[model samples]
Each structure stands twice: as structure tokens, then as C-alpha cells.
Target: MGRIIAVANQKGGVGKTTTAINLSACLAEKKKKVLTIDIDPQGNTTSGLGVDKNMVENTVYELFLEECALKDCIQPSVMENLEIIPSNINLSGAEIELISMENKEYLLKNNLDAIKNDYDFIIIDCPPSLNLLTVNAMVASDTVLVPIQCEYYALEGLSQLMHTIDLIKERLNPKLEIEGVVFTMYDARTNLSSQVVENVKENLNKKIYKTIIPRNVRLAEAPSYGMPVNMYDSRSAGAEAYRFLAEEVIEREDEDAWL
Candidate 1:
């Protein structure tokens, strides 16, 4: 079965979509069959991989509300080994519509189970809220990759997201675990960035990813062009960081299990 990893953060502008797009690309670059599911209504993940929104025949929204098959919604991306189940603006209505359905939280989980084994990894780009949609993502995922932007209110927004995860673990997916906490947009020259890094290392029980994503303008611009940083500028700091993060992720899959 594939590992369903939800790249989530309740706070917007925390690099959630950025991490989802680039990390999936890097993982696919390593020859792993990868699939990205855009659960966010923003559709940033879909566009980040160069998928045109107007051309999408089906999307994750249809899987939830339009009786569309999850497998059929998956669109092949620019990357050879990566596939994406795109999400467009139509998903915005799924929140209220889901309330009337039976087993609301399990909708995504049931839809994803059919094609879990088809890929090595399934990365979910969660919506930036603790709504039914985000809950659905949490219930569907085996693990969560939190992209914490290194800023003043970094840890402040985590309380609710963590609490929601706890509730999901207790009531829904008992096997769910935290994949890791990654620091994104870190400006190492600043005292604030260094302090945040230290705080994450000293306070959090979860494994802090060794690769910290530095704040890079190139990383920000890549999405506007509908590309990952790796494709946009392979030598940029953002590209190098994501590549390192991917290697660390693969390494930990083997080494940490032995420890």
C-alpha cells in the first residue's frame, strides 16, 4: 500500500502547497511512482505541476460530490513519474455539502483506498483550515507533513491543527502518525529564524527534518509559472533544499526504522 502523506498547515502562506508540489516532484525524480492529491480549494498544487485548471475534465471535488471515480480524476503531470488528482474552485462548495452525507470524514479515505497500491507515495495538499475538508484529508492520510514557515507566529497556529490531528487519531485513523515537522522559508541570517529552529528542536517531540527550506524568491516565483523550483531553477536555494529534504525523507525510511 502507498503511504498517504497529507502536507498540512492550518495557517495560510506556510509553504504547504510549495512543499507538496516540489517534494512530490523530487520523490518522482528518484524513480518512485508518486501521486499528488489536491484537496485544497485553492488548486495551487494542481497549477504548481503545470496542470491547466480550465482543461481539467474531472477533479478531487467530483470524487467527493459528483460521483466521479478517484482513479479517473488523476491527471498525468509534466513529470514522468508523477500524477496529480487536481482540484479547482468547484471544491469550495464541498464543505457544506459534505455535512449532509453519511460518514462524512471517511469519504476521502474510502475513495483513496481503491488506488492506494498504484503509487509509492500519495501526497495530499490539505486546505488551510480545520474544516470538514481538512478533517477528510487527515482521516485519509497515514501521516502528515507539516510545513512550518519560520516566522514570528510559527508555533502559535499549530495548537488547533495538532488538536484536530489528535481527535482524528483517536476517532478515525488510529494508525496515523506525524511524518515530520519541516521548517520552510527559513532565513538563517536572522536571529528569529535561528530561534525558531532551536525552539522546534528543543520543544517538539516529532522529528524535525534536517533540511530547512530557505526563503527564496525563486521558490515563490516558480508557482506563478506553474512549475516546481527544481524545474524552474535547479541551482536555486529552494531547489537544493527540497532535494536535500527528499534525500533525508528516503534515508529516514531506512535508517530511523533501524534505530
Candidate 2:
């Protein structure tokens, strides 16, 4: 079965969605079957993969909150090895609606179970808040990947996020683990970026990824064209960073395989 991971950060504009999109693309580039679920109401991951919002008949919101089948929402992406379950603005109401349902926390997990064997990985792109949606993602995930930006005060809200993860670990998903911490939007020219990286290296858990995503304009512009950085500009630094991250992930999985 595929391992489910949630790429999440409560802080906004931390390159969470960007990481999710490009990471999925890079993983697929490695010949790994990947399924990305966009649970954010903003649907940036949907558009980032060139999925038209209007054409989406079913979404992760429907699969979780409405008991829709996973197959109903899953759609092929432009990449041969990649697929996506897109979300729309209508997903915003799902959080509130899900609250009143029974076994609400398990909805996402249950939904993913059916499609788990279809891919090597299921990546859930979480919303930029610690709301019911985030809780759902946490409960559903086997591991969590957090993307922290390189900037002053970038650690703000991190305590809250960690506390929530701890709580979830204790009360909900004991099997859930942090996949890694990834540094995004790193500016090599700035001393602060270097400081932030140093702090993260010293303070964070040992699994922090080695690939630091640079503040590349091409990374920012790719989404506007509804494409992943790999497909948009494979030669760009941002794309290469994600590809390197994917290689690391592949190596880690290979190690796990030997175990």
C-alpha cells in the first residue's frame, strides 16, 4: 500500500502548496506512481497541476465530508505517473459540515484506504491553517512533511503546530511520524537565510531534508500558468531542488525497503 503524507504548515505563504505540486511532479519523474490530494479550499494545487476547477466533478472534500468514493475524485494529471484529487472553493464549507459527522477524523483516512494500493505515495496538500481540515489531514497521514521558509520569525506558530502534532500522535494516530522539514525560499545572498538554516539544522529533528529550495522567480510564475516547475522549467534551479529532494525520498524509501 502507498504511504500517505501530508505536506503542511499553518503559516501561510511558506511554499506549502508550491512544495506539494513540484514534489509530486518530481516523484512522478522518478517513475513512482503519485497521487496528490488538494484539500485546500483555495485549490491552488488543482490549478498548479493544470486541472480546471470547473471540470472537477468530485473533490477530496466530497470524498471525506460527503462519503464520496476516492475513484470519483481521482483524475489523471498531465504527468504520466501523476494523478490528483482536486479541490475547489466549495471545500471551505466542508470543515464546518464535517464537524457534525460521526468518525469525522477518520473520514480522510478511510477514503484513502481504497486507493492506497494504486500508488507508491499519496500526498495531501494541507490548507495553511490549523483548522478541522488540518486535523483531518493529520489523522489521515502516516507521515507529515513541513516546509518552513527561510526568514526572520519564520518559526512563528511553529510551537502551536508541534503541539497539535504531539496531541494527534497521542490521541489519534500513533503510527504517524514527521517525514522531514524542508527549507523553502532560501536566499543564499542573505545572512538571515543562512541564520535561519543554521537554527533549523541545530534545533530541528534529524530528518530535515538536505535540499533547500531557493527563492526562484520561475517557481512563483509556474503556478500562474497552471503547471508544476518541473513541467514549466525543468532547467530552473527550483525544479532541480525538488528533483534532488525526490532523489532523497527515493533513497530513504529504498532503505525502508531493505528493512
Q: Global lDDT of each model? A: 0.88, 0.88
Model 1, 176-197: lDDT tens per residue? 8888899998997899999988
Question: Any residue pairs clashing in model 2, and if so which?
Answer: none
Off by over 4 Å in 1: 255-259
Candidate 2, backbone clash total: 0
Cα lDDT for residue 240, model 2? Answer: 99
Q: What lDDT is obtained when candidate 1 is compared to the true structure? A: 0.88
Per-residue lDDT for 1-259 in model 2, tens only?
A: 7888899999999999999999999999999999999989999999999899767888887787665777888888878899999999989998778767898888888777777888898899999999888888899898889999999877788878888998999999998887888899999999999999898777765477878999999999999998899999999999999999888777765544211
Top candidate when judged by TM-score against the true structure: 1
Model 1, C-alpha of 123: deviation from truth (Å) = 0.2
- Per-candidate TM equals 0.96, 0.95
Clashes of each: 0, 0
